[model samples]
Target chain A: MALSVQRCWNVGELSSDALRVAVAVSIEMNRDATPVADSIRLVRHSGESELLARQAFDTARRAIIRCGVNGFDLPAEKYGQWREIEMTFDPSNMRIK
Target chain B: MVRFLTLLAALWLMALPVQAQNGPLRITIDEGVIEPLPFAVPDFVAESAAAQQMAQQIARVVAADLTGTGLFREIPQDAFISQITSFNSPVQFADWRAINAQALIAGAVSMEGDGRVSVKFRLYDVFAGQEMGAGLQFDGTEQGWRRIAHKVADAVYSRITGEAPYFDSRVVFVAESGPKGERQKRLAVMDYDGANVQYLTDSRSIVLAPRFSPSGDRILYTSYETGFPRIHVLDVASVGRRVLENQPGTMSFSPRFSPDGQTVIYSLTQGGNTDIYRMPIAGGAPQRLTSAPSIETAPSFSPDGSQIVFESDRSGNQQLYIMPASGGEPRRISFGPGRYGTPVWSPRGDLIAFTKQSKGRFHIGVMRTDGSEERLLTASFLDEGPTWAPNGRVIMFTRETQGAGGQSSLYSVDITGRNLKRVRTETGASDPSWSPLQN
Candidate 1:
């Protein structure tokens, strides 16, 4: 799931400030692993300001929606286990500083 | 009893969600692709017959500006699944997503009876299925339609990337003509993208390295009008100029304004030795900042006006140094395997951009204030004189080809060494100094 969504995440689209922070998005998915529309919300962030937090969350949300358009590749038998997922996007290892 | 009841309620709430049965699946994504975000910009809606042509032209310029950054790829109009027919029409996010447009821009152009034009635009995050920011509108003269288009692009870019807007700014550069050996240079100002150029000085006298003031109202450049190199400050609006430094038997050049716009710092050569100096813009005694016996020039101020970065050859080879804005001992910041010169501090006060010559090749590079994490953005036969965009995300400089027919032109590269492009000009251009964003 992480690799599937990482392919659609473009960190270059984030600002320098946004790049320095980490954001966690909570998403509710249907049984087929497709994210429920409007179910994505920023659950937690390390950003210092509201603007930076919003920017980071938006970029994270885009990655999920863009990759989940065809539904994420996940196990159907464990649908209940992965119905609600928390994805943390951290760019500290990639940021220039 | 109350404590027991509260604990029971909390436990019940925690157990209600299905994820509570087994903690929600947590995943960490630490890596991401570094690719241009795909975007689409349809022709702006024309609100009046007079603005029909301008509506399409404005949209085209906006698209060019965004794509030129190399951070964005514009989907061709033919591939667009939905057409924006009205300014206030509902956007079909599904159509945009079908075309894989991560972002969308919709705009409208209208012309009033009094020769004024208004351009309004909205940016959308297609997959998010909503507008990225509030819609914005800019009003200006009909002749300034390009500026309006740039403004719209700037707004969209800022909202999407969280970077400051720089497209609405202007650049002051030396426009060159004639042969390479006998170049006729004049000072000229134009839009950041090299459009709507207006000459500030004629070609009769040779000019070099024009720098825009903090407010973009005046220009400081070195000229040989008096048979010797001297610094001159010119009013960008009236085209009137006066010598800023005219000490007897001394030469001064490479002038830049302090962030406050009250003082100018440049290099002054006297008695065959050069050093940096600062003086008030309103005519005051010059104060020396460096007493080095080597050539010290290309002084640029930090955004907060606390320090100045300049190039000096005191260590046997040209290198960048930083010193207190007030005269003080300087500290070397460049220790690379090459000669560095023409150091300009970034407006954001994070990095210093310079021209480096190594192994017979010239390059434009940027480094942190401490001379660490040095990255070269361009390499060519001769690339020099880097000036930062208002947002400090881009650097524009001169790149001249080799040989007798070699001519100088302006080129910009992203600080990350991407989107290297030649700026279009009527003739040869060089020594570009970008101005601050316009009011």
Candidate 2:
């Protein structure tokens, strides 16, 4: 699941200010591994500025919706185990500059 | 019976831990792809008959500005699954997503009876299925429609990238003509994208290194109008100029305005000794900043007016040094091999951009304020005189080709070493200084 999200995540779309912060998003998925519409939301952020936090959250939300359009590739038998997921997108290690 | 009930409650509490371990899965994603974001911009809807042509042109310019950044790729209209025929119409987010456009821009242009044009635009995040930010509108004259388009692009860029807007700014540069041996250089100002150029001075006398004031109201440049290199300040509005420093047997050039635009810091050469100096912009006795014996020139002030960065050969080779805004001992910030010159501090005050020469190639590079993490953005036969964009994310400089027929042209590169593009000009242009965003 992490690998699938990482593939769709475009960190380059984030601004420099947004890159300095980390955002955690909570998602509620249906039984088929497709994220429920309007269920992706930011749970927490590490920045003081609400603007930067929002920017980071928007990027994360876009990645989730973009990658989950066709549904995540997951085991349907373990649907109960992955119905609710928490994703923390941290860019500390990926800062090129 | 009470003892049995207590024992059963304790046993249930013990099982809670095992069940809690099966809670929702948590994942950390630290790696992500770095690629140009795909976007689509449909022709703006014309709200008036007179604005029909302006609407299409505005949309085209907006697309060009965003894609020119190299951080965005515009999806062709033919590939768009849905058409934006009306500004008030609802966006088909699913259609945009099917076409793989991560962002969408829709706008409208209207012309009032008083010869005023208004442009409004809204940016959308297709994948998120919502507007990225509140829609914005700009009003200007019909002649200034390009500026209006740039204003729209700036707002969209700032909202998406979380960076300040720079597209609404201007650049002052030296326009060149004739042969390399007898190049006629004149001072000219134009939009940041090299549109709507207006000449400030004639090419009869040679001019070099034109710098815009902090407020973009005046300009400082070096000219040989008096058979000697001297600094001059020209009013950007009236095009009237006067010699800044006229002491006999002394030369002054390479001038930059202080952060507050009240003082000018520059290089002055007297008795064959060159050093840095500062004086009032209204003409007064100059205060020498560096009394070093070696040549020192190309002085630029930090955004806060607390420090100044300049190039000097006091260390036996041309290198960058920072000193107090007032006179004081300077500290070297550049240690990499090869010679460095033309150091300009970034507007954000985090980095410094400079022109470096290594081996046989010249390059435009940027480093931290303390001269760390040096990265070259461009390498060519002759590249020099880097000026930062208003936002400091981009640097524009001069790139001269080799040979006798060689000509100088203006080029800008992203500080991240991407989007190196030649700016379009009517003639050979060089020594570009970008202006702050217009009010």
Docking class of 2: acceptable
TM of chain B, each: 0.94, 0.94
Cα DockQ of the candidate 2 complex = 0.48
TM-scores, all candidates, are 0.95, 0.95
> Each model's DockQ?
0.44, 0.48
List pairs with backbone clashes in candidate 1. Answer: none
True contacts kept of each: 0.71, 0.75
Candidate 2 at residue B343, lDDT? 96
Summarize candidate 1's per-residue lDDT along A1-97 as a digit string, tens digits. Answer: 6766788888887777889889998899998878975999999899988788888888888999999998876668778878888889998887854
Instruction: Write down the TM-score for model 2.
Output: 0.95
Best by DockQ: 2
Q: What is the fnat of candidate 1?
A: 0.71
lDDT of 2 by residue, A1-97 (tens): 5656777888775667778889999899988778875888889999778888988888788889898888876668867867888889998888767
State in Å the error of residue B362, model 2.
0.9
Task: Report the C-alpha lDDT of model 2 over B16-129, residue by residue, as the tens digit.
Answer: 343336665677779888888889999999999999999999999999999988878899999988899899989989999999999899999999968899999999999878
Candidate 1 deviant stretches above 4 angstroms = B1-21
